[model samples]
Target chain A: MYSSLILLPFLSVIALNLPFRNLMKKLAFVVCLLVLLVQISLIVCPSICIWSNDLDIFGSFLQFNFAVDNLSRVMLFCIGIVLLAALFVQRYIIDDEERIFNFVNVLLLILIGMDGIVMVRDIFSLYIFLEITAVGSFILIGFNKDVDAFEAAFKYIILSVVATVLMLSSIALLLIVSGSTSFSSISDALKTSPDSLLISSAVAIFLCACFIKAGLIPFHGWLADTYSAAPAAVSVLLAGIVTKTVGAYTLIRIVNSVFGFESSINSLLLVIGIISIVIGALAALGQRDFKRMLAYSSISQVGYIILGLGCGTTLGLAGAVFHLFNHSIFKTLLFVNSAAVELETGTTDMNGLSGLSKKMPFTAMTSVVASLSAAGIPPLSGFWSKLIIIMALWMSGFYVYAVIAILASVLTLAYFLSLQRMVFFGRLKEDSANIKEAGLGLMFPALILALIIVAVGLFFPFIINTFILPAGNILGG
Target chain B: MRLFWSYGLFISILCIIGFYCILVTYNLIRALVGLEILIKAATLLIIVAGYITGHEALAQSLVITLIVIEAVVITVAVGIVLGIRSHNNSLDARKIRNLKG
Candidate 1:
């Protein structure tokens, strides 16, 4: 069953590239749906499969174990849903048959990569999976074949190469000290090592590389460009889950499980988290384009997840994980809405759009809900996660960070509200007056996401009791 | 024994220079060459570190993986750059700025 999780997508990539052009899109959707069904079954049974032993992928005796812990469960669940939503959105965005077909093939390849990343135990396997996901995204980002798309792809690939090289160097250093590439051996090596300098240096370099990978404040130059430049479906994948899995998840796992989240590391996370939160929100406030603003918003929201992790408490980690799920749902919903608006009005310039609420009520209402959720308004899913994060900070005696987090939440509200006003609320623009509601292909998946936002919000206690607590327990160790 | 550490540090400095080249250069090909340099440095470091710790087998396998990954990345990257060149008629990073805030 675990092998199928990777193998199914691998198979779909081949199926997607077959000569049957007419069947490509349908086949892609069906494959993604099957994958989602597999994930759901995992959630339902929860013990039908337990992957804990080492295996080799290419007969090299390199260890490739898949651990189905609580953390991986949450990530696998989220990635499954997000992949379906991405396919739903992708079908409508790309006009050319060839591009759409290739997009599906590459997307499934990426899904396999993400699933492998979340499931794999060894650091080397994680690095391989990360590269697979990166390579797929670079191609998908440039799928439009326009100057802007290629430029963004080039920037993303360049920065990613730098980050990966740094990661490789750190891994090599760790291998030298540990004599093994598996997480268990590395942790044991750290425990037995006589010298702190080598371990600390390796950890430090690894952290820096992760920051670049996650597009944290100092290394976020490529994020907004790449997010805004990619096709909307690709944007949904990139903004919603790619960075989370590739960067944030890896950082959380390595720091918590391997390095044990020391106070100094916690402090570094706190400082960087706060910096990204402030800078991302402030930079977002200055954006004129819809998708670009959403890109910055994604950066700011990811900061919240990082901040929660930085607090170094079970509650904090719970909030981070919960917010990670919530962000994926509502952010993907909002980006789909942005895609809808762009499709209808032929542009995403906020200043040039208005009164879309009048013409496209479904979209306008969904946007309002998503934006409010983002701003941490009460009764929305975002509010509960942000509240938990802030409470965690305060309880942990991070008073300053708690205050800044609160202020940033308010700033989040300011920008998203202005976004609502600019894009949906004012008098209808002359050109937008004739715009119709988005077709069901777009609306259905978004509606599903919005429903999830509400469901997660309304059933907050149940969710926390079952999902967040167990995941947090795993991370807290 | 001491020479190994010095060689590692020297390679590290060369890696830094490559990073600087990536940061300062506007040409995509130059940046890519810089990336290649960084990869080469990392490959050497891995071998040297592995030798020092007697985990040369593990390091050799990782370096092999690294080499394959580097090849894939460079191929995809150059593919994109060539596409950019065809579309925009320039390889300078400054010339490709169609999507900015």
Candidate 2:
């Protein structure tokens, strides 16, 4: 069953590359639906088909390394649902028909890679899976073949290359010192090996690369442009999980499970986290483009997650995980809303839109909801998560950072509320008067995400207590 | 003693040259060549590190692996640079300031 989760996407990719492009799109959707259902069922009962303990790929002694644990369950579930919805939405929104076919193919390949990353326990396998994800994204970004898209994709490729080189070099250094790249073995080696300059230095460099990939403060220059230039759904992917699961999620795991977070690294994390949150929010304040704002917002939100992780308490980790989930849900909605406006209004500039609520009610309502959530306004999912992260920071005795976080949330509210007034509160522009609500195809997914955003807020504990708490425990343990 | 000192000098100068070329280049393609230089320098450093510890034979394969990975990276970098130059009409990063924060 676990293998199927990884393989199904590959099959869909093959289907996508077939001559029948329209049929391939529909078929890919169906396969992903099946995969999602299978995953949910596996969560219900994880004992159906066990992955073998031994199977090697590329000459390494590969193990099954697959388990439907609580952490992966949430990610797989979210990724599955989001991919399905995004696929449906893309069928119509994507401009170039030929590119759409190519994209769906790469989409499935990226999904397979993500599934592999989530399931594989070996560090080397994780690296391989991450490389596939990176390459897949590079193709997706460059899909449009226009100047802006190409420029953005080029920057993304360069950054990813630098980051990859740093990461791979560190991996080599690690293997030289540790003799194994399996997480299980590395965990044991970490426990036994005397903390020496070689291992520590290698680990530090690897962590830096992860930070760059995650787009935290110092390394976030490439994120906004790349995201703003990509098509809507592709931007959604970048904002949602590519950074979360591959970068932040792994950071949590390695810090808690392997490196022991209370040492020097934890302090560095706190400093970086605070820097990212403040800088990201301030940067967003100056953005004119709608998607560009969300990009900065992503960086800011990710900063909160890092700050929560930096707090070095179980509550903080729990808050971080919850915020991570919540951000993915709302950010996708926000980006999709912007996409809709751009699709109809033909521009993503805030100045180009006016009193849009009267024109595209569904889009307007959903955008307001997402904006509210992001601002951490009460009764929205973002509020509770922010509240928890702030509380965690305060509890951990980082009063200054806690204050900065509060101010950042206020800053978020200020920019977002102004955005609301500018885009939805004034007179409807003649240019946007003919704009209409997105079809059931696009609105449905946005609605689902909006519903999740609100529902998670109302029933915040149910999610946290059940899924996130355990995941946090695993990370914190 | 003189022979040992000469060998260390040779390797260090090679590594330094590689680092210099990478840092001084302005064009993206030239920067990539610099990256190759650095990769060579790094491999040399790795081998020397191994030699200092008397683990040279055991570390050759890993060094070889490093060189191979660098080759792949350099090729990809060059290809992507080509595409970027076509898109932007220039490889100079100074004019590519459209993506600032």
Candidate 3:
């Protein structure tokens, strides 16, 4: 039944690209939207009998080793939400029918890729899906065909390939010791030969690859350029879920299931998480471009997720997953708002624009909601996740790390305030008075995301019990 | 064990050459060639791992899938390079630095 998540998108992309070009072009967006909506509905209500019945038709032809736990469920939900937002934003921004069709095609491919990433049980299968997602993103980034987009795409290609080589080498080494590429087999092998240098090196290499993929501090040079230079909708997709799915989520899943959270690994995650939080925030404080600053802030927020994961407790794991969900929501909201601003104002430079809220009320209000949530204000989703992570850190006796997390939250707030003041709240620049509100295409996703942030925050206990705590259960497995 | 050591040494050297090629080259195409070299080394490593572990069939299947994926990636990379060439009229990596800070 779960295999349908991967197969439905795969089949849709194939069916949508059939020889009936004119008809397919007209129907592509609706079909893709239906696929995504079905995905969301299926995950939200897994007891749906029709999906299971439909799964059997495809199941006979394709044998996939997919296992979906609560963690995967949360990630699947995020992927669906973010992709839906990206699809809508793409439709709103790109006017050419042919280009929009191409965009939809690649978008479905990425959907298949990320869905595969979240559910695959075999390590090699994970690599294949990671490549699929990476390749899709590379094309999307360079889709605009501008020089900067090309340069950013090339840099991403080089760095991403490097990460890939490292990961493949690690997988090969693991295969030598474990004789199998399944997660269970490799993990069993590691448990038996816990102290071997071979296993340790393989684990370390894999971790480094994941960090690069995730765009941590040291390997993050390509991230901001890719995010800020790509097409607006592509930025929303990349920043919102691409890096999180391929990098951070992979890191979390592999560490928990395959590597088995040793003290050394925990400390390494802690140290790296702190550096990314501090450096990403400090760097964001000085950025002049609106998108670049948000990109850096994304790094910082992802750091908090890593911090929570590094705590090595069930509470910490739950907090980490919750934060991942929150970061996806709020970050997508922020990027969507940035896209709206860039579309309307003709520039994302903070210095060039002022007082957009006067013209674009919906974008402005939703951005404020997103910014406040991202900065971890009370009664927003970001606050609850941050609170849980800090409490978990404190309870685990990592008081210093907890304190740093708090201080970094303040830093987050400072930069966001600056962003708000520069773009939304200042005196209206004379040249910007002609700017109008973005269309319903952009405003709709922003409003939906903002509502999610607030609702998740206000209904914290219900979310924690139903969604978050179940996420923690994966740690035991 | 000796077979493993010998293959490992060769693989490391290949990786070094690949990394050096990527880092030292000014031409974007050359950097891509370097990436290819790196992947070839990984592929070789996988083949050798399978040989040593007696899982030759599994390794063969994985490598086949890997090769297909690799071809797709390189094709995309080359297309991107062509796009870059079209814009700047050059493939020099140094010239492609418009996106700073």
Candidate 4:
């Protein structure tokens, strides 16, 4: 039954491309929506038992090993919500029937890749899925055929291939030490010889690759360009979940299951996480482009997630995962709002726009919710996760790091407030008087995401016990 | 152990060459070739690991899949290069600086 999660999307892509071109083009959106909706529903109600039974109908033919835990379920839910939002944004922005069809096809392929990434138990299979997601995103980023989009795609491909080479080299080294690529065997092998130079080098190299993929500080040159230059819908998808799944999620999963959070590794995560938080926020403060600023904020938020993970406590891990979910929702909402602003006024430069609240009230209102949530304001979802991480850090005796984390939260709020004042508030520009609200397609997703952010923040106690704590259980297992 | 060191040295040389090519080249096609060289080195490293570990069959299959994926990635990359060429009328990395902050 779990195999069906991967298999169903794979089959849909195949079926959508079958002859009957006109008909498939018409049916593509609905088909993709159905697949995503079913996935979201299954994860929402795990008591259904159909998903839990492990009845693999394709077991005899395909020997792929897949298992899901609380961590994977959280990631799956994020992927579904973000992708659905991207789909709706695409529909409203692109009027060409053929382009929409192609977008849906690649979107489904990415869905399949991300699902496989979260579920696969083997390192090599993990690599395969990561590449699949990378390739699909490359196509999507360059889908608009504009020069800037092409340049962005080219830079991404070059860097991505470099990361892939580094990752594969590390895998090869691990293969030599463990003689197997499966996570269980590798973990066992490392336990027997944790101090070997070979094991340590392999671990370092693999972590470097993940850092590059995740767009952490010092290797983030391509990230802002890629996110801001890609088509609007693709920006929402990439910024929302692609980087998180491939980079941050992989780092967390691998460290927990395979690397065992050694002291050296924990320190490395701590240093890099702090650097990303400080640098990403400072960089975001100076950006004029709306999407680029949001892109930088993404790096900072992911830094928080990594900081929590580095604390190496169950509470910290749970906080990291919870923050990951919250970041996806609020970031998607912010990007959706950016798309709405860009569509209505025909620009994303904050310097060119002012007083959008009068015309595009929904976009402005939703953005305020997202910005406040991102800044760790009280009673919002972001505040709880940051509190947990800081508390965990203090308990773990990283008092300086905890203080820095609090200071960075102030920095986050500073930049977002500036962004609001620049783009959404103040006197209406004389040239922008005719602008109006964005269409329902964009507004609907923005409202849904805003509702999630508020609901999650208001119901923190319930979510913490039922949804987030279970994620920490995977660490011991 | 001796065999591993010899192959490691060779792979390191290939990687250095690949990095140099990517860093020094101005042409987009040359940069892609650099990437291909890097990938080839990684492939060689995997095969050597498999040989040392006596997992010849496993390594062979992994290499095959890696090659197929590499081909697909390079093809899409070349398509993007073509798109870039059409827009700028040149492939120099220096000319594509319109996206900087």
**Tens digits of per-residue lDDT for model 4 on A97-156?**
899899999999999899999998899999999999999999999999989999999999
Cα lDDT, model 3, residue A384: 94
lDDT of 1 by residue, B1-101 (tens): 58667987789798998989898999989999999999899889888888988987888898899899889999999999899989878888888878666
- The better candidate by TM-score, 1 or 2, is 1
lDDT at A327, model 2: 85
Q: Clash number for every model?
A: 0, 0, 0, 1
The CAPRI-style docking tier of model 3 reads high
Query: Residue A297 in candidate 3 has what lDDT?
Result: 97
lDDT of 3 by residue, A245-321 (tens): 99999999999999888999999999999999999999999999999999999999999999999999999999999
Question: What tens-digit string does per-residue lDDT give for candidate 3 at B21-57?
Answer: 9999999999999999999999999999999999999
Q: How accurate is candidate 1 locally (lDDT)?
A: 0.86
Query: Lowest-scoring 10 consecutive residues by lDDT in candidate 1 chain A?
Result: A51-60
Give the per-residue lDDT of model 1 (tens digit) for A200-318. Answer: 89988999989998999999989999998888888889988999889898888887777767788899999999999999999999999999999999889989999999999999988
- Name the lDDT value of residue A306 in candidate 2: 89
Q: Is candidate 1 or candidate 2 better by lDDT?
A: 1
lDDT of 2 by residue, A255-326 (tens): 665566665787889888988988899888888888888888888899998889888888888888788888
lDDT of 1 at B29: 96
- Candidate 4, superposed: residue stretches over 4 Å from native: A49-55, A475-477
| Docking level of model 1 | high
Instruction: Estimate candidate 3's alpha-carbon lDDT, on a 0 to 1 scale.
Output: 0.93
Q: Write the per-residue lDDT of candidate 2 for residues B1-101, one digit (tens) a residue.
A: 24434654775576577557656766877766655665565565456555554556745855775566556555655666777788678888665666554
In model 2, which runs have C-alpha deviations exceeding 4 angstroms?
A15-29, A32-64, A95-97, A475-477, B1-24, B35-79, B88-90
| DockQ of the two-chain complex in candidate 1 | 0.81
Q: In model 1, which regions exceed 4 Å deviation?
A: A15-26, A44-63, A475-477
